[model samples]
Target: MADGGAPTEGRGSVAAAERGATAIADRVVAKIAARAAREALDGVPEGGAPPRATVTVHHDVARVRVSLELDYPSDIGGQCGAVRHRVAERVEALAGMDVPEVAVQVERLHSVHSRRAAQGRIR
Candidate 1:
């Protein structure tokens, strides 16, 4: 005679224990991508908060589009590359998702001289 009980170890036991799967939200992915983009700023001043990012996830694949305001005269290509790589890595590591593409848009550019001029006006 044998008792009907769940097995302690085995593929069947693992599968049986996982009664349901976990689902990740789009907003959660967007936030993580945005933070990853910020980490690519390198030496630039990130002001106060991370830049905005729009992310669309489908069937476990995430497509991210990030908007950034980078410093003027910097290595634009290098920065964008960094953002793309960082966002993909973050999404995979943190969200456990696959990011096939990361589109980066430089919406604005802030110049050091311009910032100094604006600050000088305040005083």
Candidate 2:
């Protein structure tokens, strides 16, 4: 009876350890994702607007989804592509994790004029 109980206890410990590891991984991933977003936005003008971005991590280890609303140049298609590539590369490099997919959703386009007004400034 003692030997059988020892095995059960070991298994329970292993399960708890696995859960802890997963929680740590999730936190690491979130930090990586936030860093990636900031890096991708580097060199881009914020127009004095707050960040409008959201990142979601899927249950699958190698997948991340980002939604962003930001200001970009008029010919923005290319810029959008660059943003995605930069974010993917940054997260993969910093996190040391394989990012099989990164889905980017552009939620809104911000205007400098509107942003200035919102800041109570007159052009």
Candidate 1 minimal-lDDT segment of 10 residues: 1-10
Query: Mind giving the per-residue lDDT tens digits that candidate 2 earns over 1-123?
Result: 357554455543555556564333655665566556656664445643322333445554457666666674454666557666776787667665567776766667878777777889644
- In order of appearance, the predictions have TM-scores of 0.79, 0.55
Q: What is the RMSD, in Å, between candidate 2 and the native fold over all Cα?
A: 7.7
- For residues 57-92, could you state the per-residue lDDT of candidate 1 as single tens digits? 998899999988888778989999999999999999
State, as a TM-score between 0 and 1, how close model 2 is to the true structure.
0.55
RMSD of each: 4.4, 7.7
- Top lDDT prediction, candidate number: 1
lDDT of each: 0.85, 0.59
